[model samples]
Structure formats: structure tokens, C-alpha cells
Target: MGYLTCKFVRPDKQLFEGKCASMTLVTYSGELGVLPGHASEICALGDGVVRIKRLDEDGGDERDVVVSGGYAEICNDVVVIIADHARAADDIDAETVRRTHDKAQAKRDALPEGDHQRAYYENKMAWCDLLLEKAGAQTASE
Candidate 1:
């Protein structure tokens, strides 16, 4: 099978780099699958899971990463993911994320009845949902 070079980089360091048979990136709009010789494009990523399938690896070798938000660029036989925040499945702390989700939920619940609070809650809920979804997918796939 043909492989395409894939790399994910954040501000701190180079997150990952390798050749893969297929790669999928999660954007606020939806998930996009990329393969060798795929047309180039750019997508706005949301907080969610980035799934990857290595070309020569076995089924058990699939991997996933969680990113807060970022830009995904597909070009020149390469997939470049630059995220605002990111962590691999192994790096995810479910307890920490759960706590954060709880705290956000609490803040949302305690807010006075108003548009401002409502918007805040909505945003918080969105973030929590993304975190939970990514976490769940990561655990299930790994």
C-alpha cells in the first residue's frame, strides 16, 4: 500500500511524524479522511480525536490523538496538523478531563439566568462534549 507522510506539530514540539496509509482529522464541521495523492486542502479542527492508520502496521497499530483546536493542512503528500492544545491517547488523563468537565458544568449550572451565562454554558458544554467524545473514541480504539 502507498503511504503518505504525516506530521503533527504544536508550539512546544513536534508531536508526531511518520508515513501512514490513511489519516483522519476532526474539524468542527466533520471528520476528513486523507490518503495518498489526495488533493490538497485546509480544514479548521475542533477539539476532538485525530485518528491515523499506519501503512505497514497491523490493525492493532492504529493511533489516536486529542487536540483542543487547530488547523489541518493537506498538501504535497503530507498531512500537517497544528493544534492549540494536543495530547496522544496515552497522554490523556481521563480523571483530569472529567474534573474539568465537572467544573465547567458547575459553572454553567451556577450562572444567573441571562444570555451571557447561557452562551458561556453552551460553550462549556461543547468543550466537555468534545473532550468526552475524544476520550471515549481513543479508549475504544486503542
Candidate 2:
């Protein structure tokens, strides 16, 4: 089977760079699956989990990354994902994510209905939830 060179980067650092058989991620338009030789294009990513299936390995060899927001570009069998925030499932701290979610929820509730800050806090809370979900899934699969 053919493989695609994949790189996942964040503002602080690169999270992953390797060859993958397939990748599935969430975009503004919804979920997208990429494989070797996929058409070149760019996509606006959404807050969700990015699943990468490594090449030359069993089907269980997959990595899940939680991405808050960003963009993905694909060209010539190479995929680069630049995200606002990204972390591997195994690297995340569930307690920290839960605390963040709680704090963001509290702040969102304190803001007025029409306050723009409310949206920011809401988004943060949702991102935390995604992280927690990813972490849980990884734990259960282990």
C-alpha cells in the first residue's frame, strides 16, 4: 500500500511528522479522509480529533490528535496540518482539561448573553471537551 508523508504542526512546535496510510480530520465542511495520491487542496480545520493511521503497521497502529482550529494542506502525497493548538491523545492531561473546561464554562456563564467573550469561552469549553473525549477513547482502546 502507498503512504503519504504527513506533518502536524502547532505554533509552539511540530507534533508529528511521518508516513501515514490514511488520515481523517474534521474541517469546516465536515469530516475529510485523505489517502495516498489524494488531490491537492487546502481546508479550514475545525475543533475535533485528527486520526492518523501509520503506514506498514497493523490497523490498530493509529494516532489521535486533538486540534482546536487551523488548516490542512495536501499536495504531492504530502499533508501538512498547521493547527492553533494540537496535542496527541496520550500526551493530554485529563484533569487539566477538565479544570479548563470548568473554568471556561464558568466564565461563559458570567458573560452577558450578547458578549463576544462568551463565544470565546464557549469555544474553549468545547475544545476541552474534545480533548477529554479523545483521551477517554485512547484509554479505552488500550
Q: Pick the candidate with the highest lDDT.
A: 2
Per-residue lDDT over 1-142 for candidate 1, one digit per residue giving the tens place of the 0 to 100 score = 5678888988898888988888888899888888888899999988778888876654527678878788989998889889887778777677787788788788877878774876866776676566677777767976
**TM-score of candidate 2 against the unseen true structure:** 0.82
Q: Once model 2 is optimally superposed onto the true structure by TM-score, how far is the C-alpha of residue 79 displaced, in angstroms?
A: 0.4
Per-residue lDDT, model 2, residue 16, is 91
TM-score (all chains, Cα) for each model: 0.71, 0.82
Task: Give stretches of model 2 more than 4 Å off.
Answer: 57-60, 110-113
Worst 10 residues of 2 by lDDT: 54-63
lDDT tens digits by residue: candidate 2, 1-142: 6889998999999999988999998898789999988999999999788899987665548888888889999999999999998888889999999999999999899988999889899888878888888888878988
